[model samples]
Target chain A: MARIKFSTLTEQMFYTLLCLKEECCGMDILDKIPEMTDNRVNIGSGTLYTLLEQFCECDMIRETKTEGRRRSYILTKTGREILEKEYMRICAQAEDYRRFFSGDK
Target chain B: MKDTKRRIELYSFFDHSGIEKHLEKMAKKGWILQKITNLFWVYRRANPQNLKFSVSYCPSASEFDPSDSETKNEYNEFCRHTGWNYAASGAQMFIFYTELENPTPIQTEPSLEVEAIHRSVKKTIIPIYFILMLLAVLQGAMFVTNLISDPIDILSNSTSLFTGFGWTMLFILFAAELSGYYLWRHKAKKAAQQGEFQESHGHKTLYCVTLLAVFIGFIYWIISLIINSSYFELTIAVIMLFAVAALIFLVNGVKQFLKNKNTPAKVNMTLTVVSSFVLSFLLIGVVTFGIITAAKNGIFDRESQFYQSLYLDSPPLTVEDLLGNEELSDRYITQISGGKAVLLGKYEIRQYARSGDSDAKLPGLEYTVTVVKARFMYNFCKNHLIKNKDKTEGGKVIFADHYEKTDAAEWGANEAYRRYRSANYVNQYILCYYNYIVEINFDWEPTASQKSIVGDIFS
Candidate 1:
């Protein structure tokens, strides 16, 4: 079997997965991303659409509903696992920086 | 009323961003592109508005595919959901446009977009360029060999000059365009890796100029050939050009036809190749038949004024006319033949006067008469003669003793002479005459009889 394509998630990919965790419409991700990151992470509609398709192909996300031209997707078990792992990695990195600043070996 | 405009379509092969920018600017000018052809881009009048245009290259998007193909339908649906309206597509390029202010770009992932462009260019552009470069190299090698064997012929011949110029220009343009694509791709990839979108800045000016030059050269070459060559040659040239064009279309059509059937790509490719080869073989057969028919009809008859004047009647001067001896026999041969109306006064005749017996180890003569009608041609020939005055010919420094004489009322209006002799051979020459220059080379000093023959011919 092919290995998971993106071993490390880009900022857009991470945010896209984060938006899908709530079972959101694909187009809504474009707006929710900027709000979720306080306007710091803005995912273009194209990025959202492409990421959703790739996620579906890799079983990381599944489309839950379609209305006309709109599609809504939710994160899968695999997607949740990846997101949790990324969150833990980020926390561990912050912890190391915190310890270093506190003069702990 | 829909106002339409047509402008020549000129763009570097891989300048997607530049094309988008151009389209956006045109939209602002109230002209939106409707169609593009090999020659021109057609545009329709539209309301002036700020719009965003995006171009994406999809290598697998076959031009021959039906407009509503599943792949196209899926792509259209995806873009529509994002409010990116489908505009137009040609070959591997798909265009989208939207009037939304700050509308999302169609390609947001820079690295994936860059990779897609790279893949498309490699699939479509690289192989054609490789073939073009290979042909240019082969033609260049042949040109160099021809120049080496007979520098004079290659320089003086209009066909050779035109072909050589065209091929060299094509080679340079191909090299520049190929390298330009790769260089842009390299820069774009690096910029993409850094999470930046790099707009394509290509050799647009150089590409346009070279394309124009090549187009002009091709037209001029064809017209010159028709004007200056024999009917037979013109027929062959036109047929060759048409056959090549037809073969290219046939091959492309076969591939596209196969693709439209949704055949497996590998099998379709193989069938396209095999069918094209078979059809090409048939084309060769047709060309051969045409040639044979032309010859049978005496369409290649060489009955031009030059041929009639030069060969129908015995030459005013010949080997026998120039030299008279019972033991030293004479042999005559015509070196060059054929003429056209456009080449009226711009003509040269060369003849060889050799001993009858090759084993006898005797002297020979080379006679040349060049009628210089064109001023540039006259200057070129004069310069060539002057520069190569002491050049070795037939293992002898023939033109070493160059001298001028005005009193050649005996030979012609003016005269130049050179004479050289060695143990095994003698090469002596006098290039003299009126507006038409005559050159005579004798292996040994001309006998008294030969001297009078030269005077008689010029007179």
Candidate 2:
């Protein structure tokens, strides 16, 4: 069975959405992810470009401004809800891991 | 020294791994990627360096997009920020190279990469391939129908055989490419789900072999046409080839001219397609007019007269021979035409009085000799020949024409059949020998002695 797109956010997708929380240039997200993760999580430009387009198509992101070839985008309200759900899912996974390892029910 | 080179590469549209490795190898050999088009890839001479290459697909991009389009520029800027320099792009595919030893790959997420490639393929190669495969299937069905209904004509005609072989090869190539891509995509998607990138390979060798075979077949077909066709036929063939070549060159020229002018993709595409159809019809009209004018001027007639006189091989059995009148030898013209292929050879001889002859109703003789080169084809040749004249309507037999068994001893053959049209016996007889099938038609009822003469000559 095929999974619904973006139902479960990938690591790159999570960071990309996190970067879009504050209005930023589309190209800046490529740099912001590495800086936010301390060089741990990096997204390819091609992958980022495609993701941005897809995000815009699904209304998860919308164009805010365009200067020359550089464009800015911000996460929509729908995008924030999905991002919050993903954050909760990750938190639940972490909670489960701690409970199992720390011998706490 | 030539600073640039061009090569015809057959890499699949979705075979990014293959294209990346190939570009890397070329870079190490002192050739830097320059440009790519549907026809060929161009490379420029450069210092030998170990370069890392990546291929990424932009489904929104088109081949006719302006070189400096904002979307492409923004995409390029994004790549440049990561130390990847744009090399060249064709259609929806972009190639980027980096001097940095371990620059982040252009496509990091495997699922997204696969999706991008699939989207790009859908935009370009898939539809074209699907249309071509449909054409191949249609041609293949027609060829098989002809083979079953009129085996002798198809087996004996070089053009038919060549076209059949070409279409079959094309179908095989398309099927292999389509199936290979789908299978790879399936595996790639599975790997992508597990966060692994699956490398893709193209059937480059299959492409090369199929193209070579088709080229050789085309050359053989041309040679056969020259040898077997009349002067008028040969001229028309040459004209047709030139017209097709000119149409392709002109259409491509128009597209390139439009591209150079930075025409928008939709306008460019529409104009290109419209021009192709317009140019094709124009060429056809020109060829048809030229042929009619030449015919009116008697150019083909004079040439055919000269050609006919030069290469008239003597027929084994002639009207004079059947009539036993040596004096009639000078009255009739004997024309022979045939073609030979690997499976069989077929030749037809027609002897009739010349057009200007005083005797308009001189008895004529016509016969076709089929030499089955392979034993397996003997039965097929014989069966089709026997049922060649059967009439049908809408795939159903309306009037059944058959052959009645005749005595083989008199004709000195293993088997013989006299043709019957709706129970009326005709003067045509089909004789089957060890490796030969002969169909002879007599203008007048042939005597027993003439039948023996045909059997003696053909058997």
Candidate 3:
């Protein structure tokens, strides 16, 4: 439930959402992020809590249900849209670098 | 090659001028001073790979060193000679060690005997303070005479209080440093007890801080005494010195405390240092307070005329002529003790009668004598302070000086003294009596003098 748009995000939070492409809990999100990123991006308990709290408040993510005591979260349409925008930004920058390397720039 | 690092312990003789000299000396060794903390100088070598070194002064170490037995004995003798500012090292809280290479925070309760030895150790500055105190007493007229005396007189007068004040400061600075040390050590000790002494490899900073504190204290006192000033001035001077001093301790202590929290052993050491640091400051403050009080009250010189005037072997008392006004009355009773005499003072005997006398005479004077009573008996019915704050000044004067206009003239018949408030008749007579252990203990002395004093009033 991500609500407000942020100008920039920290490395841990950015990588956390990338891991949370599906419904996942805080620990699972932390576990998945570094595992997916080949252990490059590590999120501690505090960082995960802060980021999840912000995303939930912003309405960009929604909690589906609570299994035992842990809550699970999935991105809303807005959250996916924001994630897609970030993806495109990196893709476009990557393309520019490709052009420079291939002498197309 | 790494720059030849130079780290020196600033002893009690260290001063700002001395520190400047130290810095100057360091500069010559290609080490440039970086920052200053209370009494520490952090420096870095100008050479490549930047080898860093820190220096601080602590005057107590020489006393703390067990190697110097003669010095230790002299220090003990000095403690006997001085009052409060004696060797504080004996307080069982502070200990000293030196010539440490890569010294780390030590974890253990400082030994009681080691602390005692340290306390008995003489500070380098105390003998000088004693001499200066002597000079101040001889130049008593200089309280206001500095303007006429040579420029150096002001310098001479100011130094004693300052030196005394500086020695006083060691209590604070040393305590602060020791507190940090103790906290670190205690934390270390606790962790070590739990089999976890995660070595805090290069914590020579704590040592530097301790040394700096002692050094600053020594120098401050040295400087304070060298300049012309009063105790009041020196108080502000000491406060300012400590204020600047605290900034360094707080910053360094906080950083170290937070960083050490990550490691259980380091955390234990940190805990020890923090608690010890607090107690050290408290001890320092209390010791300094005593020093300040001494400075204020001053040490008496037996040869002075002032002492001669104040000298008295007996309880000398003066009875002033009674001055009674329409609304006020007073009798001054001064006392000079004869061989440490204790005056039970006087109690009101407004009413007197024969051995078994029971007469309801006029209420002008009506009272009873009761012995074996405490100083003040609280009256539940009267919600008021019946006595004055100062018991020595005696009880308050009622119906005198400023008699309330609404004061009643007399008491009604069959009336209890408690019935009236401010203006009761029988006018709350301030019962005055002196418990004199005479030649005989008469349960009831039917003396004429006693009767006359009470009159034929309420018996």
Identify the leading candidate in terms of DockQ: 2
lDDT of each residue in B1-459, candidate 2, tens digit only: 999999998887678889999999999999988998768799999999999999999988887776566667888899999999999988788899999988988889999999999998998789999999999999999999998777888887778899999999999999999999999999999999999999998898999999999999999989877876667778888999999989988998888888888888889889999999999999999999999998888887653322331123456788888888999988877777766766777878888888899988898889888989899999888887776567889998777678889998788889999988875788989999888898999988888898898778777
Choose the strongest candidate by TM-score.
Answer: 2
> Sorted on lDDT, highest at the top, how do the candidates line up?
2, 1, 3
lDDT of 1 by residue, B28-57 (tens): 999887776445788889899788888876
In model 2, the Cα lDDT at residue A63 comes to 95
Clashing pairs in 1: B426-B443
- TM-score of candidate 3 versus the correct structure, residues matched by position: 0.24
Residue range B1-459, candidate 3, lDDT tens digits: 664343454433212223434444555566665533333445567632222122222223332233223333333332222111121232112222222343222221122122222232224333444455455444544433542432222222334333434444444444443344345445555664454532222234544665566567567554543342323344555765675566456645654454334433335445556755675677568657865676567543222212221223211211110111212112211222111101111112222222333433311222222221232321311112123222222565453321122211221111122222334322332222222211111223224443332322222
Q: What DockQ do you compute for every candidate structure?
A: 0.30, 0.74, 0.01
Give model 1's docking category.
acceptable
**Real contacts recovered, all predictions:** 0.31, 0.73, 0.00
lDDT score for residue B442 of model 2? 90
Worst 10 residues of 2 chain B by lDDT: B303-312
Which candidate would rank higher by lDDT, 2 or 3? 2
Q: What is the C-alpha local distance difference test score of candidate 2?
A: 0.87
Give candidate 2 misplaced runs (Cα > 4 Å).
A1-4, A102-105, B302-316, B324-338, B349-361, B373-376, B387-416, B420-425, B432-436, B452-459
